[model samples]
Target chain A: MGPEVMPLLENRNDIDLVLWQQDCACDRKWFLENVQGATAIIVMFGDKVDSELFEAAGPQLRVVSTMSVGYDHIDVKEISKRKIKLGYTPDVLSDAVADICIMLALMAGRNARESMAVVNEGKWPNYSWAPFLFCGRQLSSTATSQRTVGFIGFGRIAHATLARLIPFGYTHCLYLANPSSAPATARDAALAAQHHLQSVQRVDADTLAATSDVVFVLAPGGAATEHLVGARFLRRMKPTAVLVNASRGTLVDSDALATALRERWIWGAGLDVVTGEPNIAADHPLVKEPRCVVVPHIGSATIETRIDMATLAVNNALAAIAGEAMPASVEF
Target chain B: MGPEVMPLLENRNDIDLVLWQQDCACDRKWFLENVQGATAIIVMFGDKVDSELFEAAGPQLRVVSTMSVGYDHIDVKEISKRKIKLGYTPDVLSDAVADICIMLALMAGRNARESMAVVNEGKWPNYSWAPFLFCGRQLSSTATSQRTVGFIGFGRIAHATLARLIPFGYTHCLYLANPSSAPATARDAALAAQHHLQSVQRVDADTLAATSDVVFVLAPGGAATEHLVGARFLRRMKPTAVLVNASRGTLVDSDALATALRERWIWGAGLDVVTGEPNIAADHPLVKEPRCVVVPHIGSATIETRIDMATLAVNNALAAIAGEAMPASVEF
Candidate 1:
């Protein structure tokens, strides 16, 4: 359980509490033994909720609330089979994640990794500023031209990011939404007008890869979306374009991205989540690239947002305990 | 001379070119000897333009154009005394610099320095993601509260930054404009209505320091403005606030800022320029702080922006040579 969620649940007299106090992921052995008869469980993103966990919990588990926006770590099929209600924090973290998305996009385009190293490694004294030293791709639109931004997922977080990008003078937006959804050209037109963009086109992945100056991957992480941004898509991207990933790590292929950056297929990449995060080392292919700016899965990490997510998760659990609807329920 | 500017001037058969071919700052002996008979001189920030250089030029110089925004390195008083036209690239690079201002603010507030170190230093393997492990202050406004932004100098770049910030839901703006400018409450109200912000007010430095959640120093660099953000100013700031400097490094006192961060008087600082830059080493106090994010003066170092600046500098010099008004001239 998150430390913030402890106080919110500790004051309740009607329930007995079993808290995992470690800052890291709960120990597997302890979690399996302690979760034996839990009526409801609060899980972090690091915890995998699967058949084994469900089998340990027995049949009385009525809720599994996660303190995160992504439920990819949870086994939705298993939860549904057990008729357990799934609750996850979503809307509360959209703004924070969107802020990081814009931050990463700017960092990637501006060559932040190399520049920061220059300052932190004591290279500035000998580093002379040429007319074009450390020159990078600019994010804001110039007076003469506008920039276009593309998104792989046009959901709540993407919309929030779009709102922030409009003021940077990005006049065109391209997005690849759910492939199965019906095309909404009229809706696209309305969105463009509303955001003051010249156009918001619903394009195929190839066109988006080729056309956008900045490509954002904000889609879900699942089997279907795994490796959505692979070699084929990357090779089609503009040589000077930037790719930002603030969503699920599995959506982007790390190997393909590393190669693309190494060979200059794409200018740079900024990632908040990686395929096997918390295990990404200095020698990791992507981290080794000077152009790739990687942070450890901090997409929704903000003081206020984290507290809100914890409170919401706790609320979802408490609501379930009271035989009430979870505040942010997943209809699986 | 800048490499880009050389090509722009080389093809012009009307003018003779004496180029400094080195990528670094020109040697003192070469510069003084070569500049003796020159009718015009173009300079970068590293090249100081004081009375000594004017004496060396034998009073024949008609124009002093710099390929930068800040002119503190130039002796503006001497230029005015000689009636020499001073040209600079201003409006062209505002968007780029403003983009960096926003980028720095986000980075400073998001614990970018330490978080990035963890990934770059091979420490992520043992790093655990707690609820508040790397959580930082959010830049965007939450549903419950709107954030306030303050500016030390409300000029072209600050306004551009403000335009970009509005989409992040910054509802209030406080600024310390030119001290001698008359009170313009009506102007402030109009500015607020134009941006759809709740309020925009010209306030004293003390009030600005005390009120803002983010403070941006965008004023010019000179004796009058040097150390404008000193110990007292920083002490007045909120403990959770962020400070960003993109304009002139001399405007901030580095030692005071370092102490502020060390003592937890402020949350973080993001700086593009620093006093005695190109000399700041790894042991520099600000760089030593994990909360401070310093880049080596890359505010306007974007490919397109630099080209535009170089081209503009060349054009300004040629226009002055032709006895026409410079495209961008600094008036006394």
Candidate 2:
């Protein structure tokens, strides 16, 4: 739901394509009007790829590529039954998301909004210069010459974000990854060690949330992880903690996050991905809260990332139709 | 003139010293009106303390205690010839001034204003997120685990500011102090070595301005150092350089600074002192220019620093009148 990805179809015709750019709720009238003549349909989260639509599209339909990682929009059972190819863009935007996470962390910790309000209010004369007028949190160094950074997820973006924080005087990193199978957990441990981070034994989510100075939510967002940072998880956080979310909107409940900010459950929250995209009004509890800094979902919107994504999406469609290996085809 | 140092008091107690505090300028008018019976005057800068005012106050005036570092407003020659004791506040606000210098440097280099403006203006969503949206020059880290910080003046606040920048990544410091004094240069070099700075060399102003990534103007302010950062010195700077000034308003020419910022003479400027202090309105040339940030002189405005200054000023008056050592008298 960022910008229309149809700019991907501007002129390249090496591959025959069927563009069904439906971004709304799935309906029989909408599906029959456009998707019936397509070889493949590029749909987002809201569109349902039910049996009726698939049958309506008929024999020419060769692929169903959901723009998002989650494919709840598509009835995957029917797609697998027909053995159609699928594609999604992930990992590519991790760096962008990570960058936003850090931006939010710094902005929230510094109380940038309130500080700016001071200057704008024309109260500079009455306000005496002080050693610490708006001193909030130090992002980098500590009195001990060592600072600890923590992440709630150990995904690609989380690692990249960790790399950025290292230069800011972070010497220790704590991470909480979803409990993995034996082989995957071993890989995770090795990755953590490679990054010079200790692979502390996986603990409950509450422990990770409590101990981290900065907790980043970069996990997969679905029913299994809904409202992961509710009141209980929030209460466990350090008083000076900063929470960042660049993953999915549903991973956090906005009401819970707002309450935490209001009651000082945590120092601040930087949210790039809120529970509902674009629908968050200024009056939304979190938006109105001083400490909670909300940014519109722009995690993967960098020029380099966007161009790479477009090229990959195009290649994925072409390769799927030509019966070739797609660069980043979704396994699920 | 800063709000702290502007009033010229005429009477020993016109505005009821214990209550009904007035602006420094108002206090100056009150002092002028009531000076005929006054024995001493507790004054700040910007009030004309000349032969006329002295003659008006008559021969009873024994001392003049200025609540500021600079005494350009008072005729030192007249005071010396008259044998009246003079006192001015110094050494108190050095740390506070240093803090503001560092804050401005960090804020400018990070493009904090522009990014915050974008968010405030609601252009964040249309503008895609990127890894380098506001990637500005990081002042602290450079040259292999250590940063080399150079100052144009090795005064008290410059040393204090250097100390603050040390933990952020500065390991080497270079300085240019009073050109005529070799002993002053040696003292600074020894201090730098004590702080673990690689070297502190006394270079000419031109060389100091050129080689430094962040050049601070912390020298005494007066006619002797007017327009120090003119066309030639700015031309020699790196494109990523930042200039911080917390010393005096007259030290930098506002027009030249605006031109430098517009022409990219150096990366940006963090100015707590300008050509004119509070007179810098919205349409001021520097205010109109991008990358040139200006703050009304609020150095030493912290609660602790202010209380110390007020107490010191009061103590200086008491000591001068009672024939004891003035706590921090500015001896010429």
Per-candidate DockQ vs. reference:
0.77, 0.08
By DockQ, the best candidate is 1
- At residue A67, candidate 2 shows an lDDT of 51
What tier of docking accuracy does candidate 2 attain?
A: incorrect
The candidate that wins on TM-score is 1
Clashing pairs in 1: none
Give the alpha carbon lDDT tens digit for every residue of A3-109 in model 1: 56677899899888888887777888899999998988999988889999999989999999999988998989889988999999989999999999999999999
* lDDT of candidate 1 at residue A197, scale 0 to 100: 90
lDDT of 1 by residue, B119-193 (tens): 999898887667888888998888887899999998889888988899888999999988887887987888899
